[model samples]
Target: MEKLYEVFPCSETQKVLLATYTLKDEARRDQKVSEFQELKQGRMSVAEYEAKFTELARFAPHIVDTDYKKARKFEGGLDLEVFDRVGVQKLPTYVEVLDRSLMAEATLAAMKQGKAPATTTTEWRGKRSGFGFKKGRSFVSKKQNTRTSNSSSQSSGSIPVCSDCGKRHRGVCYRVSGACFRCGQPGHVVKDCPP
Candidate 1:
C-alpha cells in the first residue's frame, strides 16, 4: 500500500527516469537524476532528461570527457529498486490509483503540503476492458512460458549469466526481452549487448 508520489520527486522528468528507466542505463543515456527527492511532475523520457541535464551543465559547469567520473560524483542520483519502478508507465498515460488507502494518504498529505484537494479524480481505464492486473494468472502467454522452459533446459550452466554486468553475475538472467528477466534490462540478452 505504498504511494508512488509520496516517495518520488515532484518533477516528472526524474519521476519518469526512475519509473521507466534504470540506474544502470541512466549513466549510458547521460540523464543524471541523482536524487529521488528532486523529481517533480515532469514526464520527459530518460533520453530527454539526459539531454537537458547535459545542456544545462554545458553552460555553467562545462563538460568533462569522463562520464563515469561524473556519474560517481552524482550519488543517490538513481533509484533503481524494482518495487520503485514496477508497474511503471510513462506520463500522459498515468494509471489511476485503485487502492483506497493509498488514495486517502496521498490526498490528505497533499492537503497538508498546501496542495489543492484532489476532489476530482479520474478512474483508470485501458483501451480494452478486463485487461488489468489479476491475482491468479500472469499477463504472460502460455506459449511464452513453454518456450522459456525449453530454452532454460537447453542452457543449463552453458551460457553467460549476467545480462549487463556480464562476467557471470549470479541469479540474474541474460535475456531481458525473453524469458530471462534477471535484473530487467529491456531488450538485450544479458550475455550479449544488443547489436
Candidate 2:
C-alpha cells in the first residue's frame, strides 16, 4: 500500500500536479522561443504578420518584456518597404508602429497601382527638407514653377499618360500591369533587364 501511494501520489491535486510536470517539454518551449526570434514579415501582410508575431511572442517574454522592446522587435520583422516607412517616424509604442506599418503598406499599394498622387512624393520630400520657404520668395517661386511645369507636362485629359507605355491611364502603366519599363516584360522590372 505504501509503495503504490509513493508511485501514484496520495491526493488528486498531487496526482494532477505530477502529471502536469511530467508532460512539460523544455525542448518544445525552447523551439518556440527560437521560432519567435527568427520570425519575419516576408510575403505576409501586416495583419497576418502581426497575428504570427503575437502568437510567437508568448514563448519569448524576456526579449520583449517592455513596451519599447516589444515595439522594436515587431518593427524589426516588418517587410523592407514598410520597415523603411515606419522606421522614419520613430514611433514610441508597438501600436503606433503597427498602425504606421499598415498605413505604409496601403500607401505603397496605392503607389504601385498608380492611384497615388504625384504630389505625394514631392510633398514627402518637402516635409523632410526642414526648411520652410515664405510665399512669393524666390526659392518658393522656383519650386512652385518646377512643380507646375512637371504636372502640366504629365497631365492630359484628367488621366495621366504613362511615359513607359505612352498610354492614358489613371496610374502608372508599368506598375499597374507589372511590366518592365525596359523590355516590357511582366515577370521582371527594368533593373533586372539586360540593356
Per lDDT, the best of the predicted structures is 2
- What local distance difference test score does each model get? 0.37, 0.72
Question: After superposition, which runs of candidate 1 have C-alpha atoms over 4 Å from their true positions?
Answer: 1-42, 62-65, 73-144, 147-195
Model 2, stretches more than 4 Å misplaced? 1-24, 117-195
Shift in Å, residue 129, candidate 2 = 20
Model 1, span 1-195: residue lDDT tens = 027668753676767666555655656435443332243214543334445545544433433335433332222222233113322421121111112112333344445666443212121131123232223654434455455445545544543355565654222233422532333344445466442
Report how far residue 153 has shifted in candidate 1, in Å: 18
Question: Which lDDT tens digits does candidate 2 get at residues 1-195?
Answer: 346568766797777766666557666788899999999999999989999999999999999999899999999999999999989878887866876687678668766866533344454455356332433552444556566546645644555466777786433255655767665445678879876
Alpha-carbon deviation at 18 in model 1, angstroms: 44
Model 1 residue 17 CA deviation in Å:
43
For candidate 2, report its TM-score.
Answer: 0.53
Model 2 scores a C-alpha lDDT of: 0.72
Worst 10 residues of 2 by lDDT: 130-139
Candidate 1 TM-score to native: 0.22
Candidate 1 displacement at residue 111 in angstroms:
31
Error of 2 at 56 (Å): 0.7
